[model samples]
Target: MAEKFSGKKFSGKTVYSGITMGKVLILRKDPQIRRVKIADPEAEKERVYGAVDRAKQQLAALYEKAVKEVGESSAAIFEVHQMMLEDDDYLDAICHMIQTEMINAEYAVSVTGDNFAGMFAGMEDEYMQARAADVRDISVRLVRNLSGQEEVDFSAMEPSVIVADDLSPSETVQMDKKRILAFVTVHGSTNSHTAILARMMNIPALIGVPMDLSEIRTGMTAIVDGAAGEVIFEPTEFQCSEAERKIKGEQEKLRLLQELKGKRNETRDGRTIQIYANIGSVSDVGYVLENDAGGIGLFRSEFLYLGRDDFPSEEEQFQAYKQVVQTMGQKKVIIRTLDIGADKQADYFDLGKEENPALGYRAIRICLKQPEIFRTQIRALLRAAAYGNLSVMYPMVISVEEVKQIYAFVEEVEQELKQAQIPYRIPEQGIMIETPAAVMISDELAELVDFFSIGTNDLTQYTLAIDRQNQKLEDFYDPHHKAILRMIRMVVENAHKCGKWAGICGELGADLELTREFLDLGVDELSVAPPMVLKVREKVRGI
Candidate 1:
């Protein structure tokens, strides 16, 4: 019989909601690197280059696999890894260390990886800090390839709850999804790629669990209650029974939600509203269709610019937009132009540091100043609009002047496309009402756009003057304040007065507590995360 111990419980942050009980599978920690003196520096340098080539190949395969499993937005991390492998600075540092110390390639890679990862970890930006894990992941792969070590194969393993210090994106993607009952980690961020992948896989995952590896043994019974953010070791028979009951409840709830798929999003009295899905990439289109979303309300185009150096080409942007619009067919696909800056930064932009980036240069400010970049995206968007129903929306607009400037760029792009004899159409244009300034002037702003999509996340942050990213302000941050509801009502009234449609494309849109209030306010649409589509629809039906 397997060794048994008294039940112990630990808490963590929930990344996904579900319940499962299984044996514990402790993931092997990082490999130890032994620094060996090499006989020839040149030979070692050649060996390092060879291993990099092999790692690049492996990453390329991983990218394709991830794209198939998770979608392009989540899989883009692998592409970033491939770029990191090719980075001249990273490769040069590894080569310099090997030549200077006459050390083996594996040792050089391990040290350089730590140094680079440390630099990222020390950054003030959370997104940059997350890149530290990426650095470590790529480094580990190179080391394994150099040492002829094989990756852990979970394909043959029995279903179990995986316990790890932290899982990298690559490791999570490589595992067999069917074998993963749940994931419990000692350390990880909800914003990390691994967490994102877990959600996409629809697996129960708990992060930041405080547990000692020595206390966990393979085959030991474990229960992961992701909804409660708790992990129970050597769970008692009663605990297992309760977990099984919760699992069945979840399954029954899902079955009921699935029944609402083909049903219309209409209230009991016949008040119908468009229920759409917010997507980050092309891969999310499948989910949108699966959830029976009437259309895609927000297709965040920034994913194309992220995870890469330099700007995405006009052709690249065109193909991406085209794929989405065509795939969605006649269904409305509203694509927001690049809303880079703020927390989402690309090094190539050289945006520089700021004391208050959230209030400074970003979104429409960057696009207006950098017309060339704006033109490239507009040109692609217009060309893609020819294929199907597609509309464009600008983010961070606070004035009539900004909207006017955007139209001028749109006209210029339209003319260029016409001159080149490219098949294109000027799609319906709109602006995001995210700022207090926009809300106040929405009456005037509504006349200039075809529609309005309220980005409640930023609107709430700006209206409340609270940093949404700050944990310390969590106590005071209230999205349902009377002021916000008044603002939404005001914006909706303004849009309707101008014969324009308005929709909520923020986190609040999915808040079931306020669903009836939003409907009463005459909000025309609610675009939420894909999984929330059916639930929101169910709420609407009950209302």
Candidate 2:
């Protein structure tokens, strides 16, 4: 008879929320490499160069696949990988090692990758430290290509919980997503690309699990409780039954949410609100539609500017906007004009380093100073607006003069299009009420724009003088403070007095605890992450 084992449980940080039970699929670690002497160093250098080329091609393909699967923002990591491969310093280091050490290509790559990765790991900046994983990822790919080794064949495996020491962006993207029940890692960070992709994919994932790989075996049944951040191995019958019960409950909830599709987002008292979804790319429109969002309240257009060498041409921007506008089919699509700079830096922008970029030359500031870039995006938006329902909003606006300047630019673009005899329509214009100045003077700003969208994330940060990115201020970063609610009420009332509709497109929009309060505050709409649409709708109905 088989020996019985007691159930063991360990806690970790939850990357995504949900519960899943499946067999354990422990991923093997990378193969160890040993240095080997090469008779011809020059030949090995050529081989290394060839491997780099192949790696680039592989990354390009992965980029295309990821774009289709997860969307552009998440897929941009592969593009970054391609650029890293082309970096002269990185390539030169590998070549120099191969020639000077007279070693095989794989050994030189392994050593150089380790050295560079170690350097990045030692950096104080979290972003730079994250690049250590990228270095290791590309190195593994190159080593595999040189050795004629194949990638892990996830396609042939059955659906199970994916257990790994840590996963790189490439490895996470290349896995057969359909076969993955959940991801459990021994070591990972919430800021890691793998974590981001897992959340976007809507797969339950956990990181920092303190478990010994040797003690676990493949095919052992395991339970992943993402909400509790716990993983149970060889779960007892009672634990298994509880997991099954929770799974069934979740399935039932999903079924009921599906029924809410095509239903009105109206409260019990006949108060109606528009529930829209915020999206970063065209690929995310699928989720927006699947979740039955009334429309896209915030389409972050900056994704077009990121992950590229230079500005996206007018036609490129037009086609992207048009595709989204047309797909929504009469549903209002509010595209936020490039809100780049700050934490989101693009190399081609040549934006000099700033001491406080969040308050520096960004958003409307960059647009006003650089009219050529602004005109390009405005012209494209105008052309795309001709196809379907579309509107544009400017971020970081704090003055009437800025609004007037934006109007002048839009008029110039419209005149240019008119002279060229191009078909277009001037869509609705709005500004994000993110700054304290914007909110305080919202009454005046309301008259200049067609609508208002409250961006509570920034408003709360600026109002409280707390950097949202700082973990040290977590205790003080209270979004529910009376000050924030008062500001939202002020903006909504101001917009209403001017006969303009107001909505929220921030994290607070998805807070179920505040949904009733928002409705009572006379807010017209709430735009949140796609996954929260139904839950918010359900909450609105209950109230």
Candidate 3:
């Protein structure tokens, strides 16, 4: 009977949304690695190096395939994998172990992988913890190659929802996307690479699921609701039909929203508003265009700073900004300067622990203190401005004086570019009204900047005096509170009074319930995630 289990349900975080009804396909947690004695140590070393080359080639193939399937931005992770293989830290550890311990190549690689993976897994950051999977993935590949064993083949199975401890980018790319209905993992976060791939595939996925794998078996019927982050084992026929109906209903709703593409974003009362996307990487440009976003309202440049050992070079930063600007074409791209500190930390930045990182030594404060770093970013943004419709926005601005200081640095960068005879345009500059202080002095700050983008996430966090990251305080982190609405209205009025425009690029911007309220407040733009763009656009058209 395949150990039929029904009515068993578990909850998790939804990384992507959809309804999936399919048989369970549970993958083995990890391939069993065996240790064997080798005749020659030198031969073992060569074997390890050979495995590295083969792995590199495999990742390169996956990279090209991913770029074609997804976008260049999303496929960039494979490039990271190739780098991981080439990373001296990882490679050296394996080589050192083989030479010093006189162990076989496969054993040395496995040991080193465990050490490195453990170090990363022990890190407090979720992103770093995910990197541990990469180490294990490469190690498995090397071992499999050394042993002349073929990787697991799931091609023969019928289409089903994949259940696993976790999945890597390499594994994800190799899967038959058409055969896999969705992904349910026992471990991973919404930001994990597996979750990101699910979103890219536009399929339902539930990560960090709490379930007993022993109770799950192949051929058992299952229902995965990504939005609710719930999985039902051995669902009844009626339950499956109901889920299928809901899935079709949601798909139809999305289709209707897609019909609104190319249509002007206008309210029922003849009011026009701009709908844009808040993107973090160049790959996100595809989503922006797909949703017919008016522009890239907030390009979170912090992504360029993370996942590396040191600060990104000026040219590296420039190329990234230029790629985004050129792709957006006539549509404006508002690039927010590196907003680090708080939760977004870099070891290179050496931002020491603070009692309150959110309020201390972050964003504009860090930039103002490190003008050289700020200048490097500004120079890149300024130079890229000549290439496309690019603008600049600063985060965590609290006072008019801080805005003035930013402008002063902008002038310095502009003069240096002029001295070099570099072709650049003075991009339209603005600041994020995230702090309560910024709202109180919006009237003064509004006169200085070209526009205002209310970052409601931080605004609500600071207003409610709650740490949004803390689960205990989640109930207190109300985004639709009256105080936040009032602050947004005040900023909009201040911007309008100064003949400037105000837009929102935060979680609240995607709230359909607040769409009419924002329009009523005279907010000029709503920038949200790419998937929410059409939905927000539909809301605007209906209002």
Candidate 4:
């Protein structure tokens, strides 16, 4: 039975109802600044620069107005765009176009956006594609406002589920998370922060939904299940009752799983298994430490970079890493070095261009190219190592030579630190075995790296020759594909043969069907989504 109260929270079971949005994605674009030379070069120069300056100031003013309405801390994230507009390079890039290049302001913004659009189009990573969208969004807003178009309203629209091509940082914060049920976007992948935000808020999100927002009417009922990628619109009573029952059963299962936390996860055959949450922030470490997790399976460093506009300093990264290591006390923390691909790492730092970016430069590949960034992370890992057991893992390893090259650099840094008489710990080194080539040579890779963690997301995609981002094949990209399971089994068996532990750290590890398969294949550990932890543990314990 259901009863309506002023406040919402039902204890009997979790009933996820109401209108949930799908396909929510962020848009980022910066309008072009025009530079025109009408015979009088100096006169034209002053005019163009003035327009650029005025446009910058206008964005700042709009943001200031926005902040006064929203709280200070709540608005800080949006204000970064204003700051970016004021950057000396950004300003000069526009101002110089008018004086030296003789480009019009509108055309300049248009040219910049066009160039970026073309560049992003050639790239393979989905994260870069979304950022390219952001570039276009921010550019349009700037150009429209500078052209004296009606000032766009910054007011908060009703907290309806946002159905968009994508969501931007500004668009996401403008949305009240409590009221926004879900995001349905014509475009998006798991990489976008909009989808991540939806996941964090426990809201259902479906990306690459086959419909457009114009089809949706306000208050029209809908169903959104992120796991199933299912969205039902204008459901019948039978469907509603079925949805309710599914949610209720899931909740009851969750309740039972919660009861099992702090209980050791062991098979009925008396084999003990370690299950841990893959955390990023220090607080996540704290949150999971209270549970029955064996430890933090994966501490992703990208969160530190993505959380800010500028690159985090070595000391800053060190401290954050230290917090997680120290807090977990004796629990193990397997820290993965900067997993952000150049395509994925969308901060102020631009590494350079690439071709077939998915297979090009990313993770350890990019880190190796940018040793300064890689070394600082290694240094931080060494320093944080003093706090507890720290396992260092490199992402996107495909070749044995690349692994050796990374090891050489790591050893060089350790030697330099030794020569400098610095005291720090060097944790066990490992590599994320994700690529098809790596899985094929798992036995050899196991002989090299300290341990191996299967990043099944990329592995499956690479093996199947299917782009998960392409909605056309979304229906065909299955983790349980026979080929994928065979690859997983090969890696696990190789790790055991070489006296190295193999763990699954990707989404497939959290999936129900694959969990049993991994157990049967003899996985040493599994790091899954937080909510999936207890359930996975319960499943393992019962067996």
Give the residue spans of candidate 1 off by over 4 A. Answer: 1-7, 20-60, 63-109, 112-139, 145-149, 154-222
The deviation in Å at residue 261 for candidate 4 is: 1.1
Residue 510, model 2, lDDT:
88
Each prediction's number of clashing residue pairs? 0, 0, 1, 37
User: What 10-residue stretch in candidate 3 is worst by lDDT?
Assistant: 191-200
Q: Pick the candidate with the highest TM-score.
A: 1
Clash pairs of candidate 3?
268-543
* Candidate 3 lDDT by residue in tens digits, 288-333: 8887889999998987786444677788789889999999899899
Worst 10 residues of 4 by lDDT: 5-14
The C-alpha local distance difference test score for the whole of candidate 1 amounts to 0.87
Candidate 4 C-alpha error for residue 15, in Å:
19
lDDT of 4 by residue, 1-543 (tens): 012211111111111222243222222223235555445446644654555566566557655754654334334545655554555655565556555676556655556656656677668765455456545654565566546652333254445555566665556645445567667666665777775565444466666666545445445555565556566655656766776777777677657777887788788888866797777556455457545678878877886677444666778778878878787788888999998863476545565567676776678877888899888888878877878888899999989999899989988888977888877887989999889999998889899988999998888878888877665786777768999888888998999998999899987887777667788889888987565677788888877
The runs of at least 3 residues in candidate 3 whose Cα sits more than 4 Å from the true structure, single-residue gaps closed, are 21-205, 213-222, 350-355
Off by over 4 Å in 4: 1-80, 83-160, 173-180, 215-221, 232-242, 280-283, 286-291, 307-309, 342-353, 418-423, 474-478
Where model 2 places Cα greater than 4 Å from the true spot, the runs are 1-16, 22-104, 111-138, 146-150, 153-201, 205-224, 229-240
lDDT of 2 by residue, 1-543 (tens): 013444889898887778999998887566567789888988898888888888888888888888776556567778888888888888899999888888888888888889889999998765677679788888988898788764555658899899989875546657776788889999977645566556556678899899887778888889999889999989999999999999999889889988998899999999999999988777778889989899999998887786555688898789899999999999999999999988777666878779998889999999999999999999999999999999999999999999999999899999999999999999999999999999999999999999999998788888999986575787887779999999999999999999999999988898899999999999999998787899899999998
**Ordering by lDDT:** 1, 2, 3, 4
TM-score, one value per model: 0.82, 0.81, 0.80, 0.72
